[model samples]
Target: MPQPVPPSWKDLGKSASDLLQKDYPIHGTSLEVKTLTPSNVTFKVAGTRDSKSNVIAGDIEGKYVDFKNGLTVTQAWTTTNLLRTQVELENQIAKGLKLDLATTLNPEKSTKAAILTAIYKQPSLHTRATVDLFKGPTFTADAVVGHDGFLVGAEASYDVQAGSITRYAGAVGFSAPEYAVTLHGLNLSTFSASYYHKVSKDVEAGAKAIYDTKSTTRGVALEVGAKAYLDNAAFVKAKINNAGVLVLGYTQALRPGVKAAFGLALDTTKLNDSAASTAAHKVGASFTFNS
Candidate 1:
């Protein structure tokens, strides 16, 4: 088989943007302010001003670390119906074992949610498990184990009111220094597979295929993306999916503690069908400052 060609800097940027959007969707305009102290403490405040919706949302967070005991604590507040507070703690139990706990509280309503997670690692194996008891009587549990480049994971959620398992998922994956592949099945009906390869030191590419067996369409959606580094400080990326959606993004570092980014998405399929209907375009910009 022929080897895949390395992506260009532009492709690399687009791939990064695509993955980032999966975890953190871009709203209108946003600003983030962060500060770090010599004592290993940090503070952050971030907000989004969406002129389109005439709304503003923001959060403030503080974190402290105790290097001696391998312990870390984080507290955050967000604008909720009645300002919500959340706290997370992580501590090393032993050389290869760690524990993590987090909780969110609604002071006005006297409601709270909590989760606990544990991780253990050895020279050849790593494992993590988490339990979430957030809503009144429902709960969720998930666990994953990895060894020798191979991984297996499972997750299940229960509804106390219904007295049954509401959701479940399982995944398997294999990873190497130059390539990785993963397959996931959710609720026994939805399945997704992903493949990634490092074409070169400065470039990489990936693809994902998804199908829902229970759906009427029964068609698989394929997404392909690539990313490349222009240099140490800047890059561009692009991705296109079976749905005919295209995304492009770029990022550059202006200087220490300052960075800028821009992204755009277009409906290529609409443009192909009719020039007049090609109105699905979005653009976003963000700036970050650190001290």
Candidate 2:
């Protein structure tokens, strides 16, 4: 009998993933209270120095709306982000939708909620890109008494996703330690909170907590991060988790409507009981333009 083994395990995909952006979300509307009704689009091309490699470029087309008060609404048609980056070409064509809402209750208090869902166009060997939705509510307060800025917020979500695993149903069957395996379920939750305070006019620090639970396991990672403005040309920041994982990042403003940012992080993961620990060091950079 021929033993089962992974076929065609190439580093083509692995090498391309290393040089992508860490934080793709654009930031600037943090404390602004104006109606920002506009349609935005962006593209990012990432690749290594290898001439034989293809640069993976992604495009995000979305619309953002902010009311005169503190109410905010955003709708997006994102090609791929967290879930879509893993699979092959057929899976890459999958599509998703996101809706978000944020409002201010008082001069120093606020609330927010969001819903996101995505599904694949076709089933691949690994997964069919199952449907997943996240819905949660949060409350926040900031700058209560003589503080430059302060905030405390919490939220939770119930999510469902297609199992990223597959099994062959034949006499030989898929090679596994067990005959029957748990496929997929809709019972998962994630909770998170953060509090930010400004120490000076050009620097700020914050603490955050993120707790995630799946059908099989649960874990939490705590983080501390800071941002500094080094004049108008350069800035740097750093962060780390309780598990000794580290993240260092920086962004530089270039010209009037163009800027770039980069980040690096280290983490580990275990796929199954028999699987060995996989260590990954990731780096990403992004450029943006606005008129």
Candidate 3:
């Protein structure tokens, strides 16, 4: 009996959560362009704006991969306080093992941080550990074990300076060809459950519910979503939450390497209110090109 486990405990409910949250929408307009060069380098540029007139944020990034040494290097510059630079390196240590090192530096603020992470995996087990080299020398670790389509996992983090545990969580899940479900307890105070189902070749649906044990209001937050494939070139998604918030998204391929996405979010409870601005409604669009 072979059961595949998630990379980390945090991914226990990733499938259902992604279905309900991912590709839903953004709050502003954004565009991304990328190209791969013959020299084995990839370059990307992305920009975002609150309105159609001016660009509010943007970044340019480059990445190179060394297949022989199993290493990848990435560098990025973003518009923040003149500019911010981020560098990352990932290397495969051995079979089923890898290490990732990343750093972010802000010259204007004179601030920088570094992090290191290691990942290991086997047929029925997976584990990951991370450390913040400068801040608290914090330590975070997680592991998952699976057997016969069932999985269990746990994760915890500790801050060396605080001399205490910062957070802890656990999860259990079952995966099948047609459906998957997961239940998790987060930080010993919050609980969540999720389910994903594939109805047919072209339709999929998912739902998630979360509850806070510390909340006086015993209400659970629930969200349900579905994705419908219209054709090979286009798709549509819709989701609604317990707060009467409805979201819709559509993505279409304009050509071989170009795609566009449009998203809208509305508050049904605010529809009857006399005063409603952009607060009650939000819309955004995104375009992507890969060459």
Per-prediction backbone clash count: 9, 1, 0
What lDDT score belongs to each candidate, Candidate 1 first? Answer: 0.69, 0.35, 0.84
Cα lDDT tens digits for candidate 2, 1-291: 323222111111111122122332221111111122243222232222211233343333333333232222333222233211221122223332222222212222332223222221111111111222222121211110111111111112323243222221111111122111111111235444444555676876666655667525466667766667899787777776787656677778787666777766655332242333223454555565554
TM-score of every model?
0.81, 0.38, 0.93
Q: Pick the candidate with the highest lDDT.
A: 3
Residue-level lDDT of model 1, residues 208-246, one tens digit each, is 888999879789988888777899988777778888888
Quality of model 2 by C-alpha lDDT: 0.35
lDDT of 1: 0.69
